[model samples]
Target: MKKIFAILMTVSITYFASSQSKTFPIASTLTTIDGETINSNTFKHDGPIIIDFWATYCKPCIIKYNTLKDKYAEWQKRTGVKIISISIDPASRVESAKKFVEAFEWPYEMYFDLDSELISKLNNGSKVVPLTLIYDKDFNLVHKSTGASVLYEGSAKKGVKHLYSGKKEITDFTVDLSKYFEIIDQIISK
Candidate 1:
């Protein structure tokens, strides 16, 4: 799988570098799955935003989604943060975006950036999936990474906390978000 993925990325990068034209262009917002407008201003009033650029076929990407979906509420309550997932699977995969959401119902938001307009700017030109970006309230790019959050939780959290509060450490992965959301649902039902 690693070899296959590496080949694909290599192919993609090569193809883009050859034919993708000049520097990548970043569009503010196009349209989300739920038909909501998600742009730079959508987070104008919010704190640090975690933008996850992913696709429905990416398993590691889904793992990150499951994690954020589970801990999202607490992340909001504890830090007033927001997670925006942008799908970059091309225009043909838009339906998968909807199906993926229904299969795993997360309270967070997901946008269909099929062409990767906004996602391209995430890394300042790299069209990498699962690249999460942490930006300050003023929209200054703080940390931009291109990997799973679980593997990079320590660093991701450190930067997140630096922007969230005076704390030295942020939340860890052992928190079990899937079960966290489940418990919250159970309490709400009570």
Candidate 2:
């Protein structure tokens, strides 16, 4: 009985300890829009960090980026939160993505995962863009959200494939960015 209890306690402790420390692909290599290369582990900020995964072809991602750009200054001023934009655009679209970023003049640090290597590791082999990840000061992931879509019931059924086509208007889909902002607000308040 004593040995069984001891073993059970050890297993429980191990599980909790392992679960608390969420591991990311911190060593993954990424390239800046300027063509400079860096590792994911090099990201450093004074407070919380928001790692936003997006792509040039993702309309929902474009909307999210636009909204974030407008409020980025205020968010930084208030909470010291740093927004890191990770473009999950394929190698073929790298030039377009860089051009778009330069033309828009987004206020956040921009990086590219051309091979989807970083994003795949981060999202369990799912390379879906427009994904938002917020980490606390300690770099432990606290929140994650998949951005706007047309897949919701009663909404258009075009899905992400349509967004990639660039033929349909994105206004048909509902863009709700409130949840991400709310989560960021909560993390900063903490």
Identify the candidate with maximal TM-score: 2
Number of the predicted model whose lDDT against the real structure is largest: 2
Q: What TM-score, computed on C-alpha atoms, does each candidate reach?
A: 0.60, 0.73
96-151: candidate 2 lDDT, tens digit per residue: 99887877778889999988888888889999878888898678899977766444
Where does candidate 2 stray beyond 4 Å?
A: 1-25, 149-174
At residue 70, what lDDT does model 1 achieve?
65
Give the lDDT of residue 8 in candidate 1: 100
Q: Judge candidate 1 at residue 85 and give its lDDT.
A: 71
Model 2 poorest ten-residue lDDT run: 149-158
lDDT (Cα) of model 2: 0.77
Candidate 1 per-residue lDDT, tens place, 105-179, comes to 877667777567776665666777777666554455656557653432433342432323434322333222443
Q: List CA RMSD, all candidates.
A: 19.5, 9.0
